[model samples]
Target: VSGVRDKMNMLGAVTDDGERFIALTPNQFNAEVAKHFLRAVQHEFGERLVIILDNASYFIAKTLKKQAAADGLLLEYLPSHSPELNPLESCWRQLRDGRANRLFLTLDDVNEYLSTALPALNSPQIYEYLC
Candidate 1:
């Protein structure tokens, strides 16, 4: 999951069976990320599928609705202020506790650590913890 500390922006996504694939972007919450996420899903899953998102910004909601309408994708938005409803929040907590909390001398080091850590998060065994 991605959340800007100064803004009420959080982004998260998971597979139909609850596999986490999330990121914390430096960019602000916007339609662009939603569009990119759709593309990423297409790239990864091939078949267009319904996506779920939490309502954070109007821009994201508008952009997601537009893309879903245009691309024949289904989009569902969870009720607001309910972080626990999103399993990816647990994953984010794990990442923050495990990797992001550790100090690094450089952005590259942070990137490298996240690059190594994210894939390990995808393991089915970890999903149990999130649940």
Candidate 2:
């Protein structure tokens, strides 16, 4: 690998019909990355989409909301501590659990793992994780 880094963030979302979107951020997740990811989602789903989010600091940023509003998308926050209400939460939990006892030698390793993991999650069966 060309370089080593401590953190990588995954910005992910799922639609009501179980479409999954994953954006790999170079570093820690922040409002900027959040906004960029939202823009891509906007491009995919177009206007009037309501994105359900957890209260991560970046997701709640005023700038992100303004951008979403301008794009005709609405951002709604799930109640605190309510991961179950977020459909993507289950996929994230699976990702976490799958890697809980492992270490990746490179970012490519992480990417490979994500590639392998996504197919199982891209279907409507993702509700199993929510339950």
Q: Estimate each model's TM-score.
A: 0.72, 0.82
lDDT for position 116 in model 2: 85
What TM-score quantifies how close candidate 2 is to the native fold?
Answer: 0.82
Q: Write the per-residue lDDT of candidate 2 for residues 38-81, one digit (tens) a residue.
A: 99888877767888789999999999899888888877788998
64: Cα error in model 1, Å: 3.0
Clashes of 2: 0
Mark the 10 consecutive residues where model 1 has the least summed lDDT. 1-10
Q: Write the per-residue lDDT of candidate 1 for residues 54-78, one digit (tens) a residue.
A: 7767425776678767887777777
Cα RMSD, model 2: 3.3
* Number of the top-ranking candidate, with TM-score as the measure: 2
- List candidate 1 segments past 4 Å from native: 1-12, 23-26, 58-60, 122-131
